[model samples]
Target: MSATTTSPRISPVNPALATPTDLSSEGVAAIADQLRDLLADVFALYVKTKNFHWHMSGPHFRDSHLLLDEHSDQIFAMTDELAERARKIGGTTLRSIGDIARHQRLRDNDKEFVEPRTMLAELASDNQELTRSLRAAHAVCDEHQDVATTSLIENWIDETERRTWFLSEIAGPR
Candidate 1:
């Protein structure tokens, strides 16, 4: 007697070659939305941090400015990574400041010469916003079962959370 074997069906990924049948369409979309939201938050925070870095004034001016600039650069890099991931998953990353302003939970004061303490407060709040956005993105990634993206986001979230805590401490228990 001959044994019969069956092959598992393969799904196409290219939207051009055949009908796109993403097994995790809902998941991918959710992940995409979350990433987009995170991107906006990070971009806003990056700009805010840079602004404060340039305008911060106090006895700690030099130290605070340098740190803020470093943090802003890191945040910008994180934003780029998230945007690249979105594009990798066939989703467009939102780049406009208007889009960021619309989606951001944080506000900017845009001061010409803000006090160092005030800059610290603003940076703290912005970092907290970044934390919130990252956590939401992690949840969305979990929903989509995107482990790679999820892992990358976890590192970012942890770093942002730590930075927020440090800033909050400097802001004196607020």
Candidate 2:
């Protein structure tokens, strides 16, 4: 009954973690926020594309599956670049699948059976939306003089548009 107990000390949260970056803290923050959203959307699309790829069937199964796999790989490749860009600019990025779900603006298709044409159409629409968002984010980068991010976004926009075109062609006359 005479033993003394000591409590562990907890450190206070650091405000510096939220401080502005060399590129103007406010601007970096705004751009980072947009990038975070973009990353989430891309991740969601990647997952959806992969889902279609895995479940694809029908006369065009081989081609559709291959195309989705390629698209998913392309979308996945951007996730690292996006997260790193945010961190490089001293901005926080996604940490988990839950984080991506929270930030994603794209709709997910969980249906057991989606027609190949429908999958192509849905993915095309999503890529179009992503392109629009990328353009808007590019504007933010321009406003903040974030040339590095702007340059990257420009390439991504082109890539996304190309993906959209491919999807549109696959979808065919609808």
Q: What are the Cα lDDT values of the candidates?
A: 0.71, 0.85
Q: Model 1, range 60-106, lDDT digits (tens) per residue?
A: 78878788888888888898798778767655557577877766666
Question: Who wins the lDDT comparison?
Answer: 2
* Number of clashes recorded per candidate: 0, 1
lDDT measured at residue 69 in model 1 versus the true structure, 0 to 100:
81
- Compute the lDDT of residue 25 as modeled in candidate 2: 63
Off by over 4 Å in 1: 1-23
TM per candidate: 0.81, 0.88
By TM-score, how accurate is candidate 1? Answer: 0.81
- Candidate 2 residue-pair clash tally: 1
So what's the TM-score on candidate 2?
0.88
lDDT of 1: 0.71
